[model samples]
Target: MRILLVGAGLSGAVIARALAEAGHRATVIDARAHIAGNCHTERDAETGVLVHVYGPHIFHTDDEGVWAYVNRHARFRPYRNRVKSTAQGAVYSLPINLHTINQFFGRTMRPDEARRFIEAQADTSIADPRTFEEQALRFVGPDLYRAFFKGYTEKQWGCSPADLPASILKRLPVRFNYDDNYFFHRFQGMPEDGYTPVVASILDHPGIDVHLDTPFVSDMAARHDHVFWSGPLDGYFGYDLGRLGYRSLTFERFRATGDWQGCAVMNYGDPDVPFTRITEHKHFAPWETHEGSVLYREYSKACGADDTPYYPIRLVREKALLSQYVARAAGTGNVTFVGRLGTYRYLDMDVTIREALNAADAFLHAVQANARPPVFSADPA
Candidate 1:
């Protein structure tokens, strides 16, 4: 089968490579000029900093398979994601650990003390928390939630905490441990030459023909054995079921003389702050030192036709819209929706690669058994 992978991101590239290895012809294409999609990283000519072209992507995964898979393409350094949050005019370590709690409250409490203190502060009234606000109140209490998450989250989603689902907040770590490493992944690191080089190499096979700066959706109507679409689910069907909501980011970049924020990522949790987070590119690659720094003040906004979708705002309405898209995808023969935009869901780089690999395996199995390969990689419902 000649597999047409309609995006050169992690998902498409992985699946493309996998399909080619499995003795199938695979061609990868992307609208963007580069291969890595949002994870594209390049050297800043002026500042000599490795700038994350789309945004800062911290590759962290617990799955050894996924870690090993990525490491094969590019050598990874020992990189731990350490995030900070700024609220009420002070910066604190993120993931709401003991240090963050102690610093936020102006109390030098130990891990146990802080844990107990938070439990006491937590709202016991919210028995079965449904909304984001209630969930946060139940877990970290109102004061902490308000100071750290409420406004920031509201800004990111463009909806009040009460309107949003509790599951969104679940992604955020509420830890009692003194350890400040944001992710619990065993192997976490950035690519040696950055994401672009890794993804470019992944799609370098003779079987894979990359048509960059070329949108695949326009040519989707053309004949192909199988179309692996990694674009937005809604866009595939011409938005007939209405546009699916997505939280997009606008990167406000600036050059600085010295270290900015002293870390790779910094969250602005205050209502007064307009941006969701500020990412300093210099600190991302610790092996290389830069005299100055380049930073991106990430502002979260609603996604329009022109805007790039960073995060999927899977609200109730969006989910319903996704359902229609999913149904449309299934009925549409010789096409399978994959990746973040394809499924209209939030996915990390590791998860995307894993799913793509799984999709390829399942596809091979389907061919062997004379069954149908999955139209959608993961369940949208």
Candidate 2:
């Protein structure tokens, strides 16, 4: 089988590897000159620090299979993401942990006492929280929400918290304990070299041909036995219905001597601060020693046609547009949508790989059974 795997990100790389290993020819291509997509990383020419060109992507997953799969391609160094946020002229631990709660309130309360205190501060009247604002108010109360979330959410998403969905807030965990680990996963690590090499390793097989800077077009779908698209959902259809809403990021990079910010990620929760966070590249790889450091001041904005889409704003309007695209994709033969952009959802690295693996497996299974593969092995809608 000749497979056209579009977008040389994790999704494309993983699927291409699987198909190639199964003796199928896979042609992988991306409009970008790189392979890792948003997870692309490279050593800075000046500082010799491994910089996450897009942003910080700490690989943390509970799935043993996904962990093992990545390990097979590249060596992973144990890395825990400890994020800090500056709000009201003071830095505090993220995820609203016990220490954060205590410091914000200027009192050293025990875990139980802190929990009770927050409950008291919470709005008891709002039984069913619908929006992000309501959810935060119910969980962490007004004071904490204003200090930590309100300003940050407004800057990050470029919208009022009241307009955002409650599910967005659900992604964050508020711990009553002292643990400041950003993610609660069994496996948390970073590739020793960088993500680009990891993805390159995946596409190294002889059965797979990679064409960087080559953008896949709708007309090319007819030339392949099957097409696996990992590009934007609306992009695949030429945005006939309408463009889906997405948030894009712009990085203001600067070089400095020694440590900058003294941490990998330091977010500014104050709305007054234009950029949301500052990421010190050297801090991401603590094992590597460097005299100078590189930092990126990240600013989030509404995604434009030319801009790279980061997070999908799946509000009611975007969801309706996505549904139209999903329907059109279903009717289109010899093509299957995969990955975050195709699904119009914010997915972790592990989930993306897991789903890509499944999609490839399903395609192989369909071949064995002499049946036509479904438009989506894992439904994007």
- For every model shown, what is its TM-score relative to the native structure? 0.97, 0.98
Q: Name the Cα RMSD for model 2.
A: 0.9
Ten-residue region with minimum lDDT total, candidate 2: 372-381
Write model 2 residue lDDT over 1-381, tens digit each, in one string: 899999999999999999999999999989998899999999899889999999989999999999999999999999989999988999999888999999999899999999999999999888999999999999999999998899999999999999998989998999999999999999999999989999999999999999999987777888899999899888888887889999999999999998778889898999999999999988889999999999999999999989999999988898887788888887887888899988888899999999999999999999999988867657655
Off by over 4 Å in 1: 217-221
- Model 1 gets an lDDT of 0.87
Q: Name the candidate that leads on lDDT.
A: 2
What stretches of model 2 exceed 4 Å from their correct place? none
Best by TM-score: 2
Expressed as tens digits, the lDDT of each residue in 1-381 for candidate 1 is: 778888888889999998898888887878887888888899888898999989888889988999988888889988889998888888888899988888888899877888889999999899998999999999999889998889998898898999999888888887877889999878889886789999988887887888888886656546567888888888888888889988888989999988867889989899888898899998889998889889999888889989998788887788887887888888887788899999887888888999999988888898899888899899876
